[model samples]
Target: MSRTQRVDRTAVRTRLDRVTDPELDRSITELEYIDEIEIEGESVAVSFTLPTAWCSPAFAWMMMTDARDAILEIPEITDVAVDLRDHMHAAEINEGVNERLSFDAVFDDADGDIEAVREELDEKARAARQYRAVSALLDGGATPEQIVGLVRKDLTIDSEGRTTVRLDETLSICIESEPIERYLEKATATGVANGTDAGLFVTPEGETISPSEFETVHRRGRLAATNMSGQGHVCANLAEARIGSASASD
Candidate 1:
């Protein structure tokens, strides 16, 4: 039998608590979403369930990604695998976890400065590619509305057309787009129809609506859609702007 390092269950649990459930805006531990934690030698297996099955597949997977990162911080843990069996977006979670684990392994042995420099270069390269793509899309005669829609639906784009992003509790929107008033008006109409207050809010950057806010607007109508987004909107009113306000604090 291969010898294994002693894993500190408490430390692992504590680290897991740092990862928030993207939909609920609460720690997975507090939500009691994590179902099990199995330790087998150097490998750690985690099982979890989301608030709903149809919620944002990408966001759910992001949570799992965060969880995996947290677990891998434990020294004794050599292999960390996340299993989302009852999760709303199981496939996405599985795929995201695998990708994150692969990435983590790459940086696992790197020093802080090396990782930082590598990340900065990567970000710059990605930004350059994103700008080129957005320029191409605009050159192709894509309407502003179409560009906005693409930004709302696709996170890969980074340019003037992309207006929203989320980092922790903050949410922002783009203001550079012509007819800013019109976009807000559309957001207001969507909010009013959904019985929410202020459907959109400008981000700190003052250039885009936040991804979370965009998601809120996207999921304003229909129970089926709401269920797919997660349980956060259970009693939400899209006609008013309360949802936006509540989301800001979350």
Candidate 2:
């Protein structure tokens, strides 16, 4: 490959960072699942391993396919390959994902649709992120009523780390943008915050949050966040142990 044609390692890692472990709802890269990245001309290959050999095949499939798709999104890249290593079903996942086969086609005995599973996880992630966003707004002095009443048109997110939440015609407050931005990403994905009239924050079922139900709804969101965080810690410990075992064996 010529100088300009050389694929950037950082670019590939940046794209891979978007691929998250479904159960943990955390970036696979952040969890140190990425084992290697090899570039040959316009083709890039990624190898990853999970925290355990028996990690859910569905979750492994999702991460592998997502990583391949994310890397292919780069305009300069023409072909991408994902290799899932160390998992019990790694071979099936690797072949299925590379061949672009459906989950059912790959695993005929699988119970339900993988897309349905993905949607469920995405909703959970949205709820967890919603908790953080709402907490940020509350800490910024916005009331529960104002938050429940917010619509998609009420937020103004600028380039900086500040987001302006319009409580009403005359009252608006600024808060840190990270939480809101993260929430909006998943909210839009799960069809919670799409239109100007759509409620900016909603229940896990994607219903408008009433004032009376705000506390309960917020608590549910908090629980989702806590559950995800707890799973993340468990996965992190398992991954660390795997790494240590590998080092010891060497």
Give the winner by TM-score. Answer: 2
Residue range 113-211, candidate 1, lDDT tens digits: 433443342333222222333344445454334443343332222465543322113333333332332233333333321233222232212234444
TM-score, every prediction: 0.41, 0.96
Model 2: lDDT of residue 226? 95
- For residues 60-171, write the lDDT of model 2, one tens digit per residue: 9999988999999988888998898888988899999999998899899998889999999999999999999999999999999999999999999999989999999899
lDDT of 2 at 237: 87
lDDT, each prediction = 0.50, 0.91
Model 1 ranges off by over 4 Å: 1-5, 99-203, 206-250
Give me the runs in candidate 2 sitting further than 4 Å from their true place: 247-250
